[model samples]
Target: MKFTDGYWLMRPGFTARYATEVADVRAEADRMTLYAPVKHVVSRGGTLNSPLLTVECWSPAEGVIGVRTTHHAGSVRRGPEFALPGAEQGAGVGKVRRDGEVVELVAGDLALRVDTAQPWKLEFTAGGQVLTSVGERGTGFVTDPAGRHHMLGQLGLGVGELVYGLGERFTPFIRNGQVVDIWQADGGTTSEQAYKNIPFHLTNRGYGVFVNHPGKVSYEVGSESVGQVQFSVEDQTLEYFVVYGPTPKEILRRYTALTGRPALPPAWALGLWLTTSFTTDYDEATVNRFVGGMADRGIPLSVFHFDCFWMRGYQWSDFCWDGETFPDPEGMLARLKEQGLKICLWINPYIAQKSALFEEGRQAGYLVRRPDGSVWQWDLWQPGMALVDFTNPAATAWYIDKLRQLLGQGVDCFKTDFGERIPTEVVWHDGSDPERMHNYYTHLYNRAVFELLEQERGEGEAMLFARSATAGGQQYPVHWGGDCESHFNAMAESLRGGLSLGLSGFGFWSHDIGGFEGTPTPAVFKRWVQFGLLSSHSRLHGSKSYRVPWDYGEEAVEVTREFTLLKHRLAPYLQRAAQQAHATGIPVMRAMVLEFPEDPAAATLDRQYLLGEDLLVAPVFTDDGTVEYYVPEGTWTNLLTGAQLTGPRWIREQHGFHTLPLLARPDSVIPLGADDQHPVSAWADGVELRVHAFADGAERTVEIPRSDGPGRTAAFHLRREGGVVRVTTDSPHAWQLRIGGPDGVLHSYPAGTSEAELRYES
Candidate 1:
């Protein structure tokens, strides 16, 4: 993807024809077209031999702009294109004016200027200030001898600007000076590869850019060119969107609205999920013992996942219980469900040669084939493995029938894993270009499984513990950060990845609760318990070791119990945030920058995050129990101990094994459900709304949903109106409100209390 030899020289065997200057511009009602030649046009004869690059600009929505530059207009677009929502058609074009070689196009309040002369720049301006600009040689169309095509674009990187989000990246939280390739790989969390590679990045400069392509995009961020962020793809046509957030969170909101907002997963999905560790020997009796042990230890376990070995070792996706191990899968699932637990099974799209479906897929043309007309086979993860050709309708139906049978056996969800190891040399069923199908394969794979879940389970109830995704894959509710080592640094990296993912518009994200590889120490497990429980989704999974709390020690079980119960009690507030993520595109586990962009201290803090809009969680990342977290300008109260703190400063403190710095923002009302042990019905019987440290005469309203309504029911509204705290619960039932601090109790109120006085320490 890097084409430059150094700062000044182009690599050999490639010709660079850069857009030099715009000769003329034609303005229409809804679009502005520019004709820029690659060289100087001294006369009409000069325009005859030079290549005139045609550039088109238009406004799609308020604060959104689209630019398309083309070398050859008549080009065939291949299959496997990203499904982008059409721009709001009412995007009217307004006035156009031209200076010497600079032409400006105005659409509403957004203005785009094409600098034809020096450096051949494309600049976007709002009001009168410059937002961002693309410098000289910023856009190009490329083609290679092998019939491959590409489009390249480079945008300017300003001083002190930081870039974040390209989907669940495990590298440094900030993406500056990193070369990010939008290609999916199973290269575990420690490398430059990523399982979930999204072609989108948001900057601290208050605007976001999303490469509107699902295909593989290679981004050389300040690597190839020192002053620019360059991205290139293999295709004739390339399209991208520049979304004006004005704020980082708003940019994500608009981006998600365009692609697809994430769905709110079922409340039970948020509870602790216990999985039979991968490659561990387990039968029905073992599963029963693990489930019963958690119950006996008083640790709530909501979902029980059976890992890959559930099926025959070599024949995954056979979808049949190993007759030798699980002779009665139906009965086993029934008994587990009766004990109030959901069942999840590990599954992937690959079919091993031993699997019966392999022959069926081979005969039906449902498997990817190489250039020699033979089925593509490999022996990487499984023996003689052949990938499921999800591009084929019959293949997809064939794949879903297997899942439907699992669903019929009482399995609730699936851990849709391993769609990242896609092959680019194989042919797809629909004749999709192999290169284009590389990253997009996961989209089709997850969509098929998610759709089946939606069909089996009703709306708003389906969820997937999916691992790989592309641009529009957020529609499937929950995704987890991939494998990690059992260490503190890995835990911190996972949090950074999760926060970065949230900034990228992914609503729900989880990681292996106690790390996915090697046994974590009791202290590490206990600390991870608190961190995992506070995440948008929580799961206990691993490869070589079990993630059971008791596996570590008795104290680990106690830590799990404390956090799980706390999470269950906090469901009312968490579910509201989940609903917000569904309605708007903001994530519940938000980065510090998203919540407090104006605070300079927040832009670089990746060790902690804002849980929804009110809570700040700084997870302990050291074995010594030390935590360094930042609190924005406010009076924040510790949710664990009754400690109050003032900030805009970094606070470093020592935490015990069971506690970390989880703070509630001032002037916020965080609803706490009455139940703690169970999450399935955490919708609340009668909620106790704990109004946090509000300023005197400052009132806040909280919504309390009816118990019978959806998980996100009722709204409680409290506001400081007329120097009085006016409180109203949205539900008709009687709701109780209480005010308490480090000193015992302050006051209490009934549901119908229309007005109340603010209580504070005298």
Candidate 2:
């Protein structure tokens, strides 16, 4: 993706044409167009032999400016464009004006300015201050030695600007000085390749850029030009949007508003999920042992997942249970459901040759075919596997019907995996570009299954343990970190990826508890148990070995039990966070930089993250439980212990297996459910509101959502005036009020009290 050999020269076998001064401008109410010749047109003959690049500018939504630069206008457009649901509602909102040499298009508070008299430059500004600019020679049309065209654009990077979020990158959390390609791959947590590749990045300078291309978008973030973030695509045109926000969270809100907000997952899906690990030998008896083991240890297990090998060997995606192992799939699921556990089945979009539905799909023209009209077959994950052509409506319906049969047998959701290993030499049913479909295919594949689940189970109840995604894929809730090794290093890398994905636009995310590649040591498993249980979604999964807590040690079992119980008690707090994600685009698990944008120390920290707006979580990554984390300026109280720490500094401490640094921010009220056995209950029934470090004259209103669905919540109003903390609520259910301090629970109110006033010492 890098085009320059050094700072001054281009690499060999490359030709570049840059857009010069604008020759003419046509202004409209909603958009503006600039005709720029590759050379300066001092004379009329100067424009004769030069390529005239067509630059179009408009606004998709308020505070978002889109610019498209094209070399040829006759290239055939393709299908599989990103779904911008807000574009229609935001139409005709842009205002264009011409002031001397500067022409500006203003949408909301953001404006895009282009100077017709100067060298080609597009400057984005807000409040009359420049956010970023595409400087001279920034818009380019290039050709490689093979005669393929590429269009690229570069935006200026400031001196101390830091870039983040290109879809779950496990490399350094700061993406500056890295070459990133927006291509989906099945590479695990250790590689440069990512399962989710979104061509969007936000900076510390209060703006974000989203390349509106589903195909490959190569980005050189302060790498090629050293002072610019350059992006290129192998096509006739390049379109990207610059979204402006004075804050990082506001930037994400605007970006996600243009794309899509995440769907609110059901409350039970936030509880601990136990999965039969991949490649492990398991049947009904093994599942019963694991489920019963958790119950005996007093651990709350919400959903049970059956990974691959639920079907017969070499017959993946048959949607049929292997009779040799699970002799009674329906009966087994019924018994599990009776024990208050939901069911999840592992599935992918590929149909193996040995599967019963493969022939049916191939005969019905539902499979992707090569140029010669033959099914595109591969032997990578499964023998003779063919991809389902989701572009074909009939194929989507046929595939959904197969899954509907499993839903009939009591499956609650699906682990939609392996949509990253797509082929580019095949033809789609709707004639989409093959190169484009390689990454966009996962969108269709996940949407078809997610929509089916939404139809069967009501809205806010459908969830997927999905692995691969692209831009706007946040509509499908609950994606997990894929295929990590069982080690302390991989655990930290997984946290980095999750935080990065959160900054990208995803709301909820999870990871394998004891890792997925090897058997974790007891220390690793116990530490991961604490980390995983603290994630937005929690799951225990692995490969070749079972992830039962007792397999590691007794301490692991105790650690898993304590955290699972703790997570269940934290359900009301998490549900409110999920509602925030559904309303705005803020993620449940936020990075430190996203929460503390003004703190210089938080710009590069990746080892720790904010669990919600209130609690800061720093996962222990060492075997000895030694962790060093940063806390912003506040008197923060630990939710676990009664320890209070003041910061704007780094704190290093060694914790036992049962605890890590989970601190509640100052002046925050966290809703705690009384029941610690289940995530789904009447959340307002016997709830305890923990008020932490409420400063004088600080007041807050907390809304606890109902467990059944959205739009139903219990409201609690709290105010701290002088010494007495007053609390009032509108719910009829029983509740208690607890004033928390360095010594936990300084004052407690009785149950069934709708209003109370208690005096507390600061």
Top lDDT prediction, candidate number:
2
Report lDDT (Cα) of residue 606, candidate 1.
93
Best-matching candidate per TM-score: 2
lDDT of each: 0.82, 0.91
Tens-digit lDDT track of model 2 for 658-727: 8899999999988888889998888888787788888999899989877554688989999988998888
Compared with the true structure, the alpha-carbon lDDT of candidate 1 equals 0.82
What's the distance in Å from true for residue 413, model 1?
A: 0.9
Per-residue lDDT over 1-762 for candidate 1, one digit per residue giving the tens place of the 0 to 100 score? 877779787666555666777777787766788777887777878968667778787766666677777777787766787776536443573456778777787755567887666556789887776778876678775554444556788888888888899998988888998999999999888888988888899888878888877778999988888778888887655677777778987788778877888877887887889998897788988898999999998888889999998999889768888988898999999999999998999999999999998998899888999988999999998899899898889999989999998899999999999999899888888999887788899889988988898888988778999999988888887899988988888889899888888888798899999999888888888899899999988898889888888889888988999999999888878888888899888998999999888888889889999898899999998889988888899788887775888888889999998888989888887777777887756354557666666776676657654457665466667665444556655564445555533343535555455444543431
Model 1, total clashes: 14
Q: How much is 705 displaced in model 2, in angstroms?
A: 1.3
Off by over 4 Å in 2: 741-743, 746-752
> In model 1, what lDDT does residue 687 have?
70
Scanning candidate 1 in windows of ten residues, the lowest lDDT window is 738-747
